[model samples]
Target: MSARGFAQAEYEARLTRAQALMSKAGLGGLLLTTEPEIRYFTGFLTRFWESPSRPWFLIVPAAGDPVAVIPSIGAALMGRTWITDIRTWPAPRPGDDGVSLLAATLDEVAEGPVGIPSGPETHLRMPQADFARLRAKTARFLRDDAGITARLRAVKSGAEIDRIAHACRIAARAFARVPEIAAPGMPLSQVFRRFQMLLLEEGADWVPYLAGGAGPLGYADVISPADDRPLARGDVLMLDTGALWDGYFCDYDRNFAMGTPDPRVLSAHDRLLGAAQAGLEAAQPGARACDVHAAMARICGADEGAGRLGHGLGMQLTEGLSLTAADRTVLEPGMVITLEPGVETGGGNILVHEENVVIRQGGAQILSPWADTLARLA
Candidate 1:
């Protein structure tokens, strides 16, 4: 069956969180640009890059219906969305008061500074012009409001968990077919395509935005598989993908070898796997996020410190809690996180290990079946 669709309850929960965030940020309203925030508030999903005629923005006030502002062409789609208010705009003209329109729509309800979802620049979605227009009119633009949503989003509602697990099951089954699709002499790109086809056959709504790459040390600079270079016997393949369903993300990464990997590679893989285990063990309610990172680092053995152990995963790939050094976020029940402890050796050997976990009363429940050992394709 096709992956379970987004439940209406999930949408309501997200909106409630957004409203709470608006209150906490001291903003009369929030303007959600073309990224996850817009999708979260309105359940509006479209080809974000293709629609450039008029930008799609979601106006979420502390109270009342969420108003979706988009180009006239997208109005139909927005109308079908769960959000109640759908506003459309014509293509901006020479004297178009695009900024004025935004102010007019928001000025009535919003007072005080409007909070923008301005996380790290990479996470900000909308074009520079629209972002600028909103900023100039709003007294204050804030970053990290993602928490307003992330805190709510990170905890997967029971139904949302079902959809994610379904997605993970699809990916796990797809990985089982990796050996068949991947050949000793096939290019990394070709292997990735086959992996994607398996996913599509399983009825994925869309191929995940993420992709993986593999090669010898020199070629391990992972790319999006546009370069379909064939694999060699000595190649180490990196398989990383974010499979999505119902707007939620199932993220995990694995490493494989076309043939028997070097002992150095094998050792590193084992170390990372151990680190992952340590991180999972530390993922209990009341545990801090950095404490999870510490567990993984200690297991990696001195001098073998892997990168940040993992991060929170849900609506957006990387969300609220991050398992990295210096972050002191406390873990809570219902939080879903990814534990990825990895190390890349100078010689080109890369060891990647990851799993999706949900914090539980007993400790942590592994959402995805754990991979037992390094997968050797050859």
Candidate 2:
């Protein structure tokens, strides 16, 4: 199965760190409900989360191992983890769900405020009605976890960085073979479909996200779904993907020219590469996220108008901090982020370049195979 999850000691260290932070925040316990939060503490990884029929809960106490209060459907997998105290009930119980068991457990474990992740980018996976019932069943006040989860997830461990780098390597191999599936007269949609197959062939566990565009000048936007338009001699093709390896994602993209691209587009692509290089140099420990964004922004000028230039990446395709003029989040060692820069190429289109990188003590380390110039196709 794409490598057995992390070692037991890894989870132990995570729990110890979380408990220390919880105690300092004056929290009796933490109530985790989302997939990332639950998987972060326990090594319980499952595709059953896609069903969304049952809710999963993990309670991180002030001093010990986390308690997994999950559905019976997941007990076997949860048992495989390091957790010993597990509580389960037949899930989808209409009126109660797991609310009664969950609340009672909360009452027994938490004496002070129960911390829930209520900060930006956080989510409550359970139903709203059940959450209200849970609140009524327990006397504990549900307060924000004070960004504790985000703080810990922002900086990855050595093991996590290895997985991310592995994912990047898989993607890099797929990108190198793009010429085998792409050429003039080929449909853009087919290229997208074939690129996904290449990712799997190159050893990606899964490809959860892929986005790109093609145009005679540049694409109108990056997020638009691929159409049936066939590539022309003058077209500029870009493929951006978020491919996974053992649940870690590598998010970056490549630009290519069909036959011969416009001179303006080629110049814009080179400038985009230059801007990304600028971002790489600025990504250093103690530097704010905006500092890196400003460096790239200086070169892209007013062309990089697709919101932020880049964002943090790891477990999810995009997470934690952002590279924007307004975000002052400090960069730190072991934090993986993307350097994406773009520029206008006349009309309403734009040319962009992106690369995955991890902040290190020396500077920044490139995770994706670095590209200096635009690749061409006949």
Candidate 3:
């Protein structure tokens, strides 16, 4: 049971909450196709999602245990989950995938309106053509789920928070070892590869996302995919990673100077730190996401160009609410988010700093070990 990411009670509670919401929305069942939503209901975790060869589906009914309508290959894994009513077919059947079986199951479980996650950050994993076929085969219309999954997933359980925090600790440990592998003359690309190894060495199950840049003043962009540029004395190297641990992710970054730091770079780094602090402080349970963005933007200056200062992260690297002026999602206790602040250095370069935190009753609690100083490498 410890090996599983969450207990059975967690899944039960999720289903109960979702069913309650479904009843109010006049929904008979909820259709889930994507990895996160399925795993949210059932603890089916697998890297097999890497292959798009087959499609999978989970049906959350209005009053009973969710059903797994998946390929034969996944029946064994789905059995490990709390789900019992497993339905399967030989996948990739060319003209007739799982549409007939899926339509039948949907008809049996759902009465009137079956809801599908139709909000931002949600998508149907099945082929569009198959989905059209499914719609034609089934009697009930698949409508929007009224943001039930998003709202429920926004506030995590304590068990979920612990997993995320474990991932953060792994990334922080790997960051501390950066000096051992980085210095002047190291190619930025090699640095990226070696840093991922460090993350695995520390404890990450896998390093799904690692992007960074190196420049004199600052990196032009934080999402740089690492070129062959070498580190220099005044260069500021930034590495942002999305490392996973037990299906949870820790998303943050660290900045380090190659040898000697430039005065301008130091000033920009200090401002980023201050802005991150402000954002963290403003992430109280009742504050809106835009409020967090505004607090950090004030310190980074009003005309910052990085778009979003930070975003929510959990099973997926970026989900839920975003820390931007346009997002007004209220911060709730147990909502995990990142406070990333950036400042424009000269020549279109920007210095960005990020920290992972969870909204608590009083304020945001830092999951990653907080830092105030910019690190330097020999």
Q: Top model by TM-score, which number? A: 3
Put down candidate 2 lDDT per residue, 124-243, tens digits, no spaces: 999998899999998888999988988999999888999999999999999999999999889999999999999999998889899999988879999988899898888999999999
- lDDT string for model 1 (287-375, tens) is 99988988987876422343466788776666777787778988888888998876666665445677998888889988878977888
Off by over 4 Å in 1: 1-4, 49-53, 92-97, 121-124, 127-147, 215-226, 301-307, 346-348
User: How does model 1 score by TM-score?
Assistant: 0.87
Model 1, residue 28: C-alpha shift (Å): 1.5
lDDT of each: 0.70, 0.90, 0.91
Q: What are the candidates' C-alpha RMSDs?
A: 3.1, 1.5, 1.3
Q: TM-score of predicted model 2?
A: 0.97
What's the ranking of the predictions by lDDT, best on top?
A: 3, 2, 1
Compute the lDDT of residue 220 as modeled in candidate 3. 74
For model 3 the TM-score comes to: 0.98
TM-score of each model, paired residue for residue? 0.87, 0.97, 0.98
In model 2, where do residues sit more than 4 Å from their true spots?
1-3, 302-305
Q: Give the C-alpha lDDT of model 2.
A: 0.90
How far does residue 361 in candidate 2 sit from its true spot (Å)? 0.7
Q: Which candidate's lDDT is highest?
A: 3
